[model samples]
Target: MSRSRRRPGRCRNPNWFGQMAVQLDLGLHRLGFGMEELDHLISDPQWCAEMVPDLMLAHLPSGNDRLSQRNVADRDRFLKMTAQLSGFRKSVAASSGIFLGAEFHFDVVRPGSALFGINPMRGSANPMLPVVTLESRIIQRRHLKAGTRFGYDRSFTAEQDMLVGIVSFGAMDGVLFSPRPGQKISVFLDTHTAPVIGSGGSDTLFVDLSDVPDRACREGQIVSLINHQHDLETCAFEHGITEYELLARLGSRLPRKTCPIVLPPCIGKQGAINTRDQTSR
Candidate 1:
């Protein structure tokens, strides 16, 4: 049977490789071979002289002391065992295994988070495409009196009369509430950029919107979640969870208008494509 441990669930749309495995199994069944007999066919040298197992997927656990305790010795043992048992045409290192160097990268590497530019291994330079961008609209703008307390827990008490922009996006919308001191964040306004200061606990994110020079950012102005410079993995580490869990926890109630830049056509009506070919036409 063809299976993948990487995506452990029922199949909705099987790929080309999955379909081929189904066809092969049907052929074997027609030849009077049971399921166990078919399993033996690949390993038995005399059963099929020409046939050989073509691919093997290896999942190497990351050696993080806090997260997991899998080490190099465990990986080496698995690889050696596989090599001795069968002729592996291609072997893939899954997930965090991509950071394990050339030895782990037998032929291919299956990395899900690394594909989205999230570096699980701290200090390693990430080279991958960022996949998510968050944006919110300003709900209201107001001036808070000096010493005025705000939010549910009175997290921030204004030291001075400060202009604050209340955004529709909040902790519920996947915008993290907690931020480290001096952490940089941005807000997009009418093709101009505004710097926002994140200050407060991790649950209730508070941004100092007093620095916005433009008066037009009064209300209904959109702010982008800049993923380019912001490290989501680091944020998740601070929050005590995997990056995958953080993404999955994002509430669906928040009106998400997909950025046409990377989302597929089916997600939304295709936006105007800007290219030389279209410009010339």
Candidate 2:
């Protein structure tokens, strides 16, 4: 890995010895540095033994600036170091690093977000299967008077007298308050689709009753959190948090149901079907 000029206030110079261990396997014989200063460090046999690691794992730091220009700096440095070193068979790039394009796709790509159907970077196409669903139960429905205060702190005052449904989900369940009065979120109810409007709160999700007037969803009705056409990162940004935190913050009270996905039989393997019948039969 190419070393950067150590950031201000940092005592030790930034070195690539640790990063080199991760890209290459246990058998590392040589070490390269950014310039003569790093080269001198590697020259010390005792220092080389201590710094030269057998195996290493390079991961992007969490929190903000994770997928920004600094990510590019780290990725480029690692790529450069790997290229300079010989006999390195495999290299792996993490989620944001893959966005550097196919040039960064070495032997393998470790994609945690894409595997869960989340596009980490904005404006990029995601090619992974979605694996999460959110559902909420309705608790109550009431008709509100015009200018009635809703929720704690009297955040929302009704525009006019309207019916509202109290849902089980809230900010505790990852629902965030919207700046606008009525932000519509698409939800699936069995075979039917409907909209759930956002009401200001950190612990309650509200739905406008006027939007879906046909079917009456009473207490104990289950609604799915719609994820098909929306981006998770966009949702996180809307919620004023990082994508990783948004996923991590999903409340544990929500019950999860898992089902196995089966693929079609392999065509040419041992248990595969043979199309050529006459001679084989």
Candidate 3:
């Protein structure tokens, strides 16, 4: 039986067992075997003899609450308990565990968000540059009178006469967003920003374009949903989702373009990659 608790719902299949990578539940409760569970596996002579451990993995929780004493103690306990294991050549810290300290980083590090320019260390100035930009093309434009309702369930009513543009991107395109009470969500048109004003439609989004200049409000004009100013972190924050979820939820139907990275001053003429999602017009 696989002792790692990474996937609780996954059925344990004995047929596939050849070797094992021991997962230690350091702080993140979602995966790995607990200390008591580890002890059981270690003491079981028949199981120990059959299975060989390839490596130990301990994932430390990230964000503001990661530095708790209990987590540190758990890690200390894990180290002490795993010291006797002979075969596993390395200890690896996954994801944000790399930032916890050098001790957490043993032989390897598995970085996720940091690779895509998300700040692994939150609450600090982001050291990574923007790597993705998601744009939606305006497919149509309309003028609304005050009291006119817009989108599904009539979620928004025009407060005053305003110009609005419908973009070819919405909930179906992984833009699952809703404004909080008294809050506004926006998309950028060059230097101007237009507020999203209604329930997310399946394949279209309504943006109030009254603030954007007439020249920039033309049909087929690209409006940025994710840019340097409104990066993945910001968009995810506004959507009340994680950066990983936002990235993962992006619909596969959208067109993708990969271009050489010439932007961001720090790179300075170096070769890098940037991806753009062109969500139709």
Candidate 4:
């Protein structure tokens, strides 16, 4: 209701008409009209007639306390108030709300994080398919002798002769330079995982490739930084940060490509070829 001053004028203009929505602050405090303001807003005949809302939405920002006594009570109050509006479609649920039973679900539901394969409910196993894969190409390989110090500040000293692969990913690309205490960060290729060695450079990180097959450790080989086994949530946890922060910190310089959608057999050969051709191009 912060846009109350402009709504009346905009709604009154015949040419400016569009689908309108009202947000009620159930408890989020981020946006929306307070419970007291809702009564005042609906009571004004001029305002109601002019601003015809098509949708009524109330978002629950915190999923952790969703089922708490206070939240349930607030949700009930919101439902009671909005039930009177016969014409308006309602949406009160998000990703976490899906598990809270059907009552929270109205005419529509908005699953923001879930759409991006992020877990809607914290501390629960994720049920969404991973849609993102972060990878980097191997740039170089090094053979270090026993007692050889590696990386910035010589954080790692080789215990024996080993092969190390330098990857294109680094701290600038949302990867940590050094693992946190009691944690080990790694990248994968096929079934083998290579632990990161020492600190990272601006655009490069060293991985202990001795355990990986020689063929897989070759130059220009692809290494999975974030994958199904090492998902965003898992990687973020090892980095001592949230999944959101890890995603947001991804370097702008990194190239992004969407995975081709697999169509069912019913779509025919032409459709499959078209998708492949587009992806290839």
Better of 2 and 4 by TM-score: 4
Candidate 2 residues lying further than 4 Å off, grouped into runs, are 1-80, 83-89, 99-103, 145-147, 177-199, 213-216, 230-234, 240-242, 255-281
TM-score of each: 0.56, 0.59, 0.76, 0.82
Stretches of candidate 1 off by over 4 Å are: 1-55, 63-72, 84-90, 99-103, 129-131, 153-155, 174-176, 179-206, 237-245, 254-281
Worst lDDT run of 10 residues, candidate 1, spans 19-28
Order the candidate numbers by TM-score, best to worst: 4, 3, 2, 1
Q: Quick one: best lDDT, which candidate?
A: 4
Q: 1 or 2: which has the higher lDDT? A: 2
The candidate that wins on TM-score is 4
lDDT of each: 0.52, 0.54, 0.74, 0.77
- The candidate with the higher TM-score, 1 or 2, is 2
Model 2 has an lDDT value of: 0.54
Encode model 1's per-residue lDDT on 1-281: one tens digit a residue.
Answer: 53322112343333523321111221213322233434454455542343334554444444322134454655555454454435544343544565555565665556666555565464555534466655667777778898998875676688888877766656656645454565555556655555454343333334567666656576777766445444556546656677677777678866555554564464443333432122221
Point out the higher-scoring one by lDDT: 2 or 4. 4
Ranking of models by lDDT: 4, 3, 2, 1
For candidate 1, what is the TM-score?
A: 0.56
Per-residue lDDT of candidate 3, residues 1-281 (tens digit): 55533232243456776656777876577877777778777776655666667877776654323555554665676677688677675554454556566666666667667767777665666656788889879999999999999788888899999999998887788776557778788999999999888887788888999988899889999999999889999998898888878888999988998877566575443333321111000
Clashing pairs in 3: none
| Candidate 4 residue runs with Cα over 4 Å from true position | 1-15, 62-67, 260-281
| Residue 152 miss distance in model 2 (angstroms) | 2.1
What's the lDDT of the predicted structure labeled candidate 1?
Answer: 0.52
